[model samples]
Target chain A: MNTKSDILIIDDDKDMVETVGTVLEMHGYAVRKAYNGKDGLSQIEKKIPDLIVLDVMMSTDTEGFDVAYKLKNHELHRYIPILMMTSFPKYMAEKGVEKFQHILGENWPVTEFLEKPVDPDDLIAFIKELLDEKNP
Target chain B: MDQGHQLIKDQLFFRKELMERIDWFILLRWIAVALGLTGTWTAYFIGYPIAIWPISTILLFCAFYNALFFFTWRHYRLFRSDDIEYYIIFAHIQVSLDFLSLFAIIFFTGGFFSPILLFIFFHILLTGILLSPASCYTYSVVVLAAMGIMILLHITQILPPRPPLFQNITLPSSGSLFDILSLYAIFSVTIIVTAYLITSLKVSLRTKGRELLRVSKELDASIIKLKALYGMVKEMHTCTDLRTLTDSATKNAAIIMGVKACSIKLLDDQRRKLDFVSAYGLSEDYTKKGPIDIGKSPVNLRIVKGDRFSIGCIDEKEAFQYPEDIEKENISSLICLPLRVEKMIIGVFCIYSGTPAFFSSEDVDFFSLMADLTAIGIENIRNQENKAWFVKKASHQLRAPLNAAFSMLDLLEKGYHGPVDPRQKEILLRCKARIKLLGEMVGDLLKIGIKRANMKMSALFDVDVKKKLREVATFYETRATEKNIRFQLQIDESVPTIRTDPQLLDHIFSNLISNAIKYTPAGGSVSVQLSMDNKKYIVFDISDTGIGIPDSDLSNIFTEFYRSENAKECTEQGTGLGLVIVKEALDGLNGSITVESRIGKGARFTSRFPVPV
Candidate 1:
């Protein structure tokens, strides 16, 4: 049964999502892309992927975090792994109090956080590790 | 010291006023002596058979004392301003002499029923004003006792009783010793009652004055706090020019403080001069007195170095540089307070009054608070000013383009563009590296400009030091692994927790650790060691086996965008702002960092922060 691991990439930046999706597809994984949280949620509803690759580097700091939190809290998709692309965990520890209140947690809703400008090989290896752990 | 100085000033005022009162007292005694002589002569001329020898002798005695006091006061002032106790004693002596002379006049003219007896009330009032209540009551007691003695002597016939000077002085027309004693007793009671009334009235009046002062000071403080709050809320919506904002604030300061004028003078660092920036309630001619050179005016120089001072009178001394000019402008007194945001002095705020010694100690305290608020307000407005706002917004806008370009170059450099010439590939690699550095620099500028303003007020929290360090160390470990560098992290088991802002601690560790990883060559070691120093502080030692800083460049490493010669050659990847941000973040935590390096042997940065007391 020629079944490939399905992956969904969600990011506000269309080019970033396309490039990252192209790299992931090159690694023999079937890929899907969504530009915002709404499209990402609906894409998951159509077909749950093996792993969800999300980008927390967005126009607003909390939008990405809100998506991760919703996915983590969902009854059906709570177990699905989310690989969050964010510079925030290191770039700025916490911004203002009001902005950081929801983002301030030792246990982030995502399975792992990857810094931006991530190396292509490192990206493949991290996704492989998350997919293997979920399927194996 | 200020309290003592205020005391001396008050005493100076009291002494001058008392000296004038003494001059008036001497003049009045001479007038009384003249009246006595004329009254005695008239009694004789009208066939009253008055004794001339004793009355003339008494008059001459009064005149002698009057001359003595008058000449002494005119030639040599006995008491100085600080001699407040001495002035009290002088007043007592003068009052006592008057009482003795009055007693003599009353005894000679008539015993208790004499018309001159009313003079005792005036002396009692003076005593109440000059001396404390206890001393005033003592003087009244002495006067009454002297009258009793005269009556006693007359009754015993030891001193002959003279006829009443004023015939039919009272309705009783009584000259008997018992009537005199009864009248004398009543007179003594009246004197004591008058003294008690005057002293009590004086005390209650003083208490009310003190109450009013306290209420006024409290009211002033409330207004200052409210003004600061209102300014903060209003400034958020409107980005006003610095001069326009400060000019309005200065104008309000004058109205609130009830001063003649208020002004601000900012320190011009390059010129080493103070420039008058904004002034309210001052004439244009006065404001155009030109910038005051710090070298020429030691007062302003000290103020720029954080000093608060005041000049009581512009004509009195050279406490300010343009004292003469200010005097011509009808500004008599001025208070110069350093407007300090944190420990740095931004400028001087002056409250000018047309009256001498206008600012009280309370005024200094209130203005000092206002100056702090003003300094902070100026910083706030300056932060949102065109330059700062542009840097913040422009850097943010620059970051997006840089990142997009970088992402595209990163994809191409990763061979996603497929087969290309070796030379072309080298050029693309260089472009990627250059773009990466540019991106990091853009990020660093954002950190310095916007992040700093947001994190100005450090949010302190009790941090598990081991946890925060491990988080930062683990993050850098991966980066070090990618660069083929050996990274080691050692945390002492006995490492105590710290009360500091988590972001600041994270910022320091992240920047310094990243630099260590970025600078070191492949196969070199980078290590982070956390330990306690004598239980006073927790120390973080971040060492790298990399190209060390030159001896000459070590001092300038923390300056903004300052990169060492070796660092720039080894890596064109640095933003040259990592160490600067590190040092500043460390300083915000009340921590210090020191670096020691050898040419080829690597550098170790040791940072120490105080433990929670």
Candidate 2:
């Protein structure tokens, strides 16, 4: 059995999924990839990932939201933390609290939110923080 | 308006009521004539000591006169029902004839015991209702004179007198001469007293009726004006551009005041001039009088400095800055009101009248209310326009992304996200399902960017241009009414329906018509004509008698947000995106539009769409 943490990168953008997979691979974490919400759910059914990287707009604008919801509520994968990404930073901003609640609702289905065109260092740091929180 | 025109309408209603009462009087006269004839016949058949021949002759005479009155009444009702004055004269003649006939019957029958003597009392009351108070008093005098003549005939034993109605019956107590004379005296006094009371009562009642009518008319006028004002402001809020909104608004203000003309002049502090932004009811010759320099005009300068000034007589030159323009426009009296938003004086609102000193203090006060609301509306619109781009720009950035994903190819992007470089990171960040859409959006979609962008590219359906133009025409017609402008829409039977996006067509028609209305001054006309046959196109001609486009500005009007200098002089605000949007939408539909105009004359935009095969 593999001892390394398994990370799932699910996104509609091919480039986004490949780059995330490559980065995670470089960081020494085992990674799997899915290009859509349906494929991501099917991949989780095969073997649940320790962490998930999801995009807001996919095949549909809200498809990423649907995938995150499914993973968080799953019996086996419920503990996996999701990092949600969005191209619209205004809606994702923590300082834009009213907008956040209006678009995303009071209970965010994911562990945290991140803006698009995200820096790699910031993305890794956030992922490590979420993984540690889950593990601890 | 004080609803001055409706006062004439109220009088017509009052006269109709009066005509009904006259008809009732005619019916009663017929009843009296029937009664007289039958009563006379019955008395003669019963072998009373009365002369049947003379009594029958008198009754027939009364019937003949009544027939004449009946004919007159019928003729008036059918042919000249609105002849109020004629009816009054006819009523007087009938009343006098009835009085003479009744008095004749009393004289022929027993002087103190005539059967129809009591009808004189009804005559007194009828006179009060149908005639003026002075005429009612005069009728009472005629009554007394007739009575005096009868007394003289009784004393002198003139030709002959018919026996009393009850002379053949044996009465236990007959009336003595003293008692009869005393009763006649009492009858005369009561007739005069009744006439006095009825005259006073009818005067007060008619006055109350007139007051009620005036008050109700004023109320109706107020409600309609208020509703129109509310509808205008609400519509103004929905309008994104300034020129069209203010043009429609100025038209409304002129209508609200019931004046011949009204103009809103916006102040340019930098230029120290007041330029006419929008006007309703002003002659195009006057609107073309150019701007009023504050340094040159004392009255307008005072208004700009927040003082309300007026010229009771434009020719007097007391308050008028430009008498020559006033004379040229044939303007008489005018009120110049300061438009203010808070403490700052923004512009002047003017109302012109053909009559000298036409605007009462009340008129000025009411106009001030409209001015205050308009100032607030302008300020609010300016602020909203400034903030409108934020939401629009946001939606434009959010394109309906394409569906795709490539986990490996995206990873190859330099500094490619997951944990890599920012540029490559950005490229790698998009999900496979959305990256293709993002690429095209950043790629081809932006080539037709911003102003001339296509309508929500997905929602295309067959548009009914004819029906849509009718609805839009009906809406602008009311605004036209306020400006005394004639608006018309005509579609040829051969016009064809083209298959295209209804929204884009709507934008094309509305933007063109709205511009027509905005440029057209008061007393001008705007029209939309549609035609199509075996031609290459379904054509629409939107024409207006307005300030026409200058040759220089004409070339640039279709550029995004390009407003003409003359248009700017007429209105302080305009989005200038209307023609651009129309041009783009037409282009999308593979249609074309061309403008024909002469400065200070008018313009016509002829648009054509290729027939869809």
Candidate 3:
């Protein structure tokens, strides 16, 4: 297994992007940054990243959910792992997840949800766990 | 002031028509009185008979007074259409008395020598024109009855019998009894024909007037309805409550289309279900069945486009199918309008009629306009609610990260996380300061959201005014002393207890005191006073000899995200939500606040809370 996995960071906040990007980079993961959902979708099109870190609130609050829905519906991207990120309470995150399920049905592509200002060590561990999952 | 003046003007206009009718009647009565008095005086001066003058004058006076009284009473009860009947009857009575007086004068004054008879005849004619047929007949019958009684009395020798004025000039031997009877018959036939003609003409005129009035009234009602619709359209533009706007629009649509019921169902974000938020003319039991899930229902097949459900009507041959429940409720006709906001269909507005083919293209157009307005209002409310929810949730989530950062910084500062080098210590201090700032920002955001959402504090209890003031003053005393500022609390012992959220009260006081300390110079003083006003309100005045607010900024100090220029220059750490929170909290308690300030001298804030009885 590779020590560093390619991680895609999608967020509108410059401070958040810089801080989280640096944290993951220091932990030996190749990190990519996208300023918005549009750029993040294009980045996914260019190459299928190992894990996608998406912000629920970008240009719009539901942009992240919409992108995730589109990805889950696409045949090629349906199997890719996606992680939702938000600076909202756990209940709000759950609501977003439920809404996503409502849109794409029970079979969704989301692997996990992370709160903003993520702990560097915990993020790395979550990524490793997703990578270790059996791919069907 | 303008509104007050307009109200008075409207009241005056309401009385205008009634006033005009009364004026005409009053003038006529006055004229009659003057004429009657003049005639009686002339008769007396002419030596025409003292007894006749007094009787005629008395009758004339009575008639004038009665006419005036009747007109006034009718005017007062004009709102009752039934009172018109009484008015017509009274007018007939006046005319009848006038005719009897005219006949008596003619019979007594040399057999038609006096011209008053002609005046009385024309007056009766006018009365017939103004009144209904029944009243005219009543007046003519009374006149005939009076004449018959007079003739009978004369014939019976109960009264002096007077001959025809031309009897002296004619030879009675040449005139036969047949000639005399024929002349009497001619006069009787003429009077009856004249009365019939006048009465029938009046009846025709009254019927036409009544029909015209009915048409006019219907026109006025339709105009009022149109104006109300215009007002609703203008109101919809400014309305921020989705339920209220939808309810008004649906109800108005139902009325305009003359339908049995109307409803507005908003699709959830996922578009899998519809929630009925407002409805009119629908049974309560039906509304309580909860929102309908579109995917699982058979009715969806009729409305859905492919896999997407249609929000409009459903018909077999009409490209849409009507729901069975709608038909069961006797709603055969319907028009369903989809409400789209930002290109996403968010809701449907529907109108249901009991008659088949009741809704037409014109109705559909009007309903579309209504739906457009409803959609805009719903969008505004949804956006506002979402924004409030996001802010609240974001602030709550921020607390955890902020706490973690603060704790970690605290551990580093206390040397608990191993020995820190000078450079590391400097970084740790900076981190601590930034984290503190972030915590304050989060608190400010939360406060603003709570104020905007009108969130009420959970804890409420009876708080002694004096005790509360003392505690607040004592808590801030240390900070005041540290700045070398004199702090004092003056509590009126007579002030009573108040029901309030103590924690919120504490926050209010703390913010005010902190602001006072922060703005006050080293030697300035701050004082807290509590007293009862004439209204029995517990007035709390916080006066600080700190830099006062400018007059221009005083009015906006309590607005969310608003900061006084002076305050902004003094501190950049504030979130500008403290005063907004204070204002909202006071409003929830049915209290009020006023501020007085003199720049560079001092400031005083007075809050008045109604003392619980």
Candidate 4:
């Protein structure tokens, strides 16, 4: 069995997925890519990853959210964490207090939200931290 | 009846009631005359000797008074019926005459011994019903005294007593001492009792009438206030201009309160002074002497602190601020109401009257309602301005980082930091493209946001439609060329330039042209045609040779975030918000758009905007 920590990236934007995957791979984490939510779910079912990198807007808007909810609720992949990225930080902030509660509440399914075009160094650091926490 | 105008209405009601009573009295007087003539003739023919001269004289006197009352009432009508006091005196004179005639008839017929003396009580009852209880009592006393004197004279042999000619004419034992006493007691008691009963009924009727009058007056005043409030609230919506709002507020306040002048004073920016914002029916000198210092003017400062106060006689106060000014201006009464939005007091609404004690409690209450509505309008306008400002600020902030991201990515693709291989270069190109697309989408979305916020505030200017359209065409030519698509621009010289917002016009053309290019496939053509249609509308026809919209999705073409199946299959980067922005921008211009399309054939959009006069 491959002992390296595995990360699954679900995004419709192939270039963004590749860029993030390349950064995570360089940091010694095995990275897998799925072009859409359906592909990501099937891939995670075959072998669950330590963490999932999800895009807020995809083939259809909110496709990433659908996949994240599916993975978090699945018995086999329930332990996996999800990191969400979006192009519209203001829009996300404008969802108001109820959205914040769901995002930061104790039972929140997603780990964190980050803005798009994330710094390459920060992406690798985030993946390593999530993996270490999950394994430990 | 306290004032001249009030007397007019009360006098009208009184004259109507008096005419009705006079009609009844005239008919009664004629009936008494007829009865006197027939009864005297019948008594003579029946061999019953009676005193006919006295009854005839009294009947004549009754007829004379009835004629005089009727003629005088007619004359009063001609002389202005509002002189109701004259009618009251006339009625009093009639009542006294009625008592005199009844006394004369009773004395001539049989003195206090005649049963005809009971008719004296009838006149007393009429007097009680027609006049006040005090007047009725005085008439009752005169009748009683007249009967007493006739009795005393008859018993003392000073005046001759007539013998009862009619066999039924009985005089309580033929005027003996005890008989006279009992007759006097019975007459006095019956007359007094009738007067009391009639007077009590009259008093209650008057009370009810007065109460009805008061209630009706209050109802009229309230209806006037409610209608004025309704008119002012309706006017508030059309008064989008803040200056016009204040001006209309003062004018309407003056008209509604029946005041000589009205003014609105708002706290200045520093809140240390109250500046006169608007004034109606005030002299220029008076308005110019304003901008009162709140620290120095205690009364005005109290109003600004949310206290309502009024002065019934401004000229009488020695230490009053603006006393000299108001005295010169002939302003007698003044009311100041605090204009409040929720708990925050923003200004004072003031009304001045030339007559002292003019602003009643009801007037103040109505003014308070108006001031509260004005405050709400002020708050509404302030909130709209704040929302517009916030939108501008937020868009500016959002645009900064998005542009930064686009520039940073551009620098990255240019190998500013390092050299890149073919594989890295390909990846960089994709990233740059994605970044560029996102940047464009954000810019379009913000344009929509800003345009919505600026609907009320956007300034208009003369625009060269052809020039703007050509500029947009040039800007999008490279994007069209990248896909090997052709672009054609046609402008009819007859389509003159129009007046519109320049930035909004640019957005309109840019969005339509950019959408055409974005949706059209390689080797397709996009053409724009602008011309004057029917001399009233400027028509724009933009046709694209590309994937056409489905019939089922045509209705939702302008809905935000709605992309058709064909569109999604053709392009992954489409935000589906461009047409929505275009439609909204056109709506602001009072323009309309239509589309015609068939699957795989092509699509064409036509727009028409009314030509500005």
Candidate 5:
């Protein structure tokens, strides 16, 4: 099997990043990692990935969204689809943040949102669909 | 301030009425001048005659006076209607001068025999209608006396007697003394009688006007107090701190009482002293007079024991509380009310004014109301803080570590960590299930916190009810099929769209459906029906053939952290908070929910929302 499609994961939770990364690597995919928005941008600068799985909240409340917004707008990395994840649908609902789907349109930056603790099977399926859409 | 505004409004209304009356008087004066000028010119041209020169000169003088009267009316208009008192006084003086001019014209014509004497009666009637009866009666007496003096002067030859213009016509100079006496007697009786009748009618009118003004002032004062109460209630909603609440309460109390200053003194932790917590319209020195010792301050001690204290003057300075401070602040009157939550006295709300006897029994009643509201607000804040602290430290801290453990377990279950034996795998599956249950409990607790902290219905958006029902049904479709249960939906076409938080509505339906499927045995069915209930409500009924709630637990099912014994046994993963969250979410929608259940049969939950949502 050709594990050629590269996926970059940016999350502040160390254990979540490790588990999610190991799952993707085991599923025949090349996985790269960054802890926060600043390092994530630098990782993309070094080499662009085929897909990105980003966290909605990291060092700050919306740091991961900021990184995804930047990458989606940049000409070089605009083609890469983003899968946004957060453990805070409950937390952010109380904090009065509008839902991610309402903030951005379907044709724009982030492709989808998944609530955590990130299920390994769902994450792989989302990555495969995004990659297949890009190739098709 | 309200009273002042109302009084100004009353003045404007009175001024408008007076302006209309003045317009009529101005028109009458102009008409009299026109007629007087025509009669004088007619006599001079026809020679069929009267005393043309004197009558002409007097009429010209009358015209000049009336022109001045019009200018005075114009000047009155320049003054704001707020200065209506000045306008009333001006009307009195102007009408009196009008009576004087009428007397002068009658004197020039033929005294009692002059036809112009009748016009003086019209002026008397106008005065009685427009001016105070005292002024009107004064004008009446003046006109009668002036005419009587003129007739006497003419008959006794003290003033010049004019020649009769016609040969046949008899003048006052030609009449006998007896005829003149009878005329004088007749004019006196008629003028005095007219004045009596008109002034009598005006007496009841003046009394009623005074009564109306008094009632308006009382109403204005009461309205101010009501508004102050409303403002206090609104301010209480936004304040979470005791000091902030007390400060705002005292300020509003001062407004309601119309006092110079107000202060709140709370019993300190030991309950032995009254500390000044907040004060409005008070000097720094007064507020800083230090806390009151229950042993030393007699007045405060009495208030602390729940007795209201009112003092009109500070004569016995030593006996009163804060003697030197009260004298220095120039406080002439004082009212102290005990702020009580139920029977327990919490603090004292006091009002101080520089005017003696400023506060009455009515003021006491208002101050007591203010104190009661303040106490309730304080109690609510205290309770909210306690609940928030308990939820925060207990649930949130417990959830963080639980979340980390769940992520690790997910990795292990997926075989990302290592290989596992069949026995170890069984144990892992049980652990995962228990962990999921723990996580759900934490989530439910956090949901309660969110509901309490910020579940404002004002932030709701329009939601498609049919679409939401479909989404919730689809979300639970797999779970329903796993249990071999029939999941059904009966939605009416007339079930209108509702305004609510979409996530909350999803939570409500999800909890109800999830509980239904979880409790029901295999082959049992669950159904959701949405329809319009009459004209005012949209109703949702969720029913299932399930191990229904025991009748004893029905009342408490909607309370937080309550689960039936059978429910717990059937599903060890149940959080027991589903119905609590559902009830809170319904409260946010301003809706009502009811449930019917039997122990072995089933349960049906019916929720109704008001239309126009």
Candidate 6:
């Protein structure tokens, strides 16, 4: 809890971004917002955050993935902790996870997956645990 | 042998009679001419004061020529008309001419009792037998009138009251009364026999002609029915639409069977109820009743109960048991045939006739054949539709997972968690590539489904092909460079902007370029060239110095579910649907693709599209 964590939220949904941002901010975490992948990547370049929270269907349905792919491959930003969130059905989630595993492997830089509508408390707990682990 | 001999004898006799008639007419004419010349010569050589002989001889010559002209004219007219009535009229004219000539000969001989007068009786007998009774009676009356006129002239001394021209011959002992009596008796017998013979012959010929006409008409009707059956079979063979096949069958059945109405009712997938799919002449009120329960309806019950076919008469059947609806609907007779496909009854075809007892066993058999053919056609179309529907549904279901996978990969790439090690980074990159491959497969599936359903893309707009190609080329250029392969784009400046679905265009170009980069080895190059042809067609040539396809796989490259042997061995990532989707998309735009390749050499794909005028 003593370790400060900066979280970036990239999503086209203003409501989702604001809600998730407020929830993480209430837990004493620094929060940044980017409405689209292009803006999110520019923000990341200026200041690489501790953790990035990404929504899959933003700008275009696959924009979040395109941004993640570019960031993960970029040598400078490849090591940042990332948490993926989606509201798709379970079968879709499985397929998505399978694809993600294929691309990023079992030990991908991302921390974990959060299916929406995300429990605010759970989201905070995961963030705190990851931040603590980073400090430890 | 006896019948043939008798026929020949009869023909000979007829010919002999015709020749004899011709000979007599010729001999009479010659005699008349000779008599006229001799009489005139006698008057001049013997200095006889007989002016009557020359005058009578000239009259005889005129009578002969008049008879000859009348006979010849009548015979020619008979051949010209060829009608039975005209022949009858000709017969009468000939008979009349014969009588007139005989009278002239007798008068010129200066007596009422000349021997040539007997020829008139023979002529009357011949006319009675040859012609019908009507003509015979007419000739008899004329002959009697001529005889009376001759007798009156002789008694009144109006026929030149001089010595007979053959004064050397003795007077006949037979009386004038005897000649008159014999002639009257002959006329009476001729009339009776001619009437009986002609009437019998006319009645028999008419009966035979009517029977022949009836048989020929029936044959023609049968032929028409057969032709219709042949046409229906041909249509059924090629039919892909269930509704059209059912509609055509019902309409054609109603027409060919002469039924008041025909309808087809098929059970839905549940098989609990029957839905009327097509109707020919049913009332709108009945049609609005919608699908009926097969078990509840009496007509369907009978069809299900009977193994072969079922026939029901609306009038004879119990009102309550069969329902008054059918009777009120004016369907007096109903023939139901089960449409069976692979031993399962999928539907029933019912034909209604307004009259009771309209359909027979034969009608039921014929209808059953039609139903069988229709069942096969319907089943085939249903199978195709079902397959198409599954492909669409599967593609839709697959989208959700694909989206989630893509997003998850995106998050991992972004490093939302702690820093990833190099190994982890490599795995994540591989995962991204695989996810991309899955996305492309799903996209191909979607494109194929849309093509099959004939659904147009939601978005269409004018896009610069050159700009799009350059963008795609730039995106994939690094990947190609990583493998030491060259990626180049050659776009014509004159090429105008094309109206197309942008997303679809992106997909097409990405797939082509990706494949080119994937298959090409280091030191090889991939080129994408866009140009406008002479015919104002936009052509794209994507040439790759990649491991080219074999000659054997070229034809099947664009087929769905068909993977080339070489491509499978070279790469296992593709769904083998890239070219299939490309072909379908191009087909929608009225474009075509042609490929040229060799086993070891590079492959070139040429896509040609017409510029919108």
Candidate 1 residue-wise lDDT, B1-613, digit = tens: 9689856765666576667777777887888889889988887888875667777887898898788877766776663335777777777877877787778777777666567779889889888876778999999988878877876776676776665566545423336656776877789889999999999987786577557655776797777757864664365324334665677668767776779899988887684888888899888888787887888777788788887888776764455666667767788888889988888888889898998998888788877776777777787776665455465446645655566566777778778868777888899889978987887787776666644564333335699998999999999899899999999999987887777667778778899999888788999999999999998888999999998889999999999899999998997888888888788777776789999999878999999888768
Question: In candidate 2, how many Å is residue B283 off?
Answer: 6.9
Winner on DockQ (4 vs 5): 5
Supply candidate 4's per-residue lDDT for A117.
Answer: 59
TM-score of each: 0.45, 0.48, 0.49, 0.52, 0.54, 0.48
Question: What is the C-alpha lDDT profile of model 1 across A1-136, one tens digit per residue?
Answer: 1688899998887777877887887788899999888888899999988898887645564567777778777889888899877544233423322334433444457787776777888988999889889878
TM-score of chain B of each: 0.40, 0.56, 0.54, 0.60, 0.57, 0.54
The prediction achieving the highest lDDT against the true structure is 5
Q: Candidate 5 on B1-613: residue-level lDDT in tens?
A: 9689877877776687777887788788788878988977887788655767766777777778778777866776635545778778767766866776677677666666777778877877888888777777787788777877887788778995453543455766667889888888898888878887888888787678868877987998798779879988998777755666777888888877788899988888899988888989888888776888888888888898999988888786766667887888888998998989999998888999999988789888878888888889988876775665455445644654565677788778667789877888788778888987887887787777768776231244588887888888888878999989999998888877776677677778889889889899999999999888886787889999999999899989987778889888887778889999888878866788999998889999998777653
Tens digit of lDDT per residue, candidate 6, span A35-133? Answer: 899999999999999989987765564676677777878998877777877654333444444446644666453466776545566777887777667
Better of 2 and 5 by DockQ: 5
Model 2 residue runs over 4 Å out of place are: A1-136, B1-14, B33-57, B60-78, B113-115, B166-189, B227-231, B234-238, B267-275, B280-332, B338-346, B388-613
> DockQ: which candidate is best?
5
Stronger candidate by lDDT (3 vs 5): 5
- Evaluate all candidate structures by whole-model CA lDDT and list the values in order: 0.77, 0.73, 0.67, 0.76, 0.78, 0.69
Per-residue lDDT of B341-459 in model 4, one digit per residue for the tens?
89988888999999988878878888999999998987776676667556644654554355445545644665544677888878877876776676666767766776666534444
Distance from true position, residue B114, model 6, in Å?
12
Off by over 4 Å in 5: A1-3, A69-80, A90-96, A99-109, B1-15, B18-404, B416-421, B452-458, B464-466, B501-504, B550-565, B587-594, B608-613
In terms of TM-score, which candidate is strongest?
Answer: 5
* Cα RMSD to the true fold for all candidates: 17.7, 26.7, 13.5, 20.0, 13.2, 17.7
Candidate 3 docks with a DockQ of: 0.07
**TM-score: which is higher, 2 or 5?**
5
Pick by lDDT: 1 or 5, better one: 5
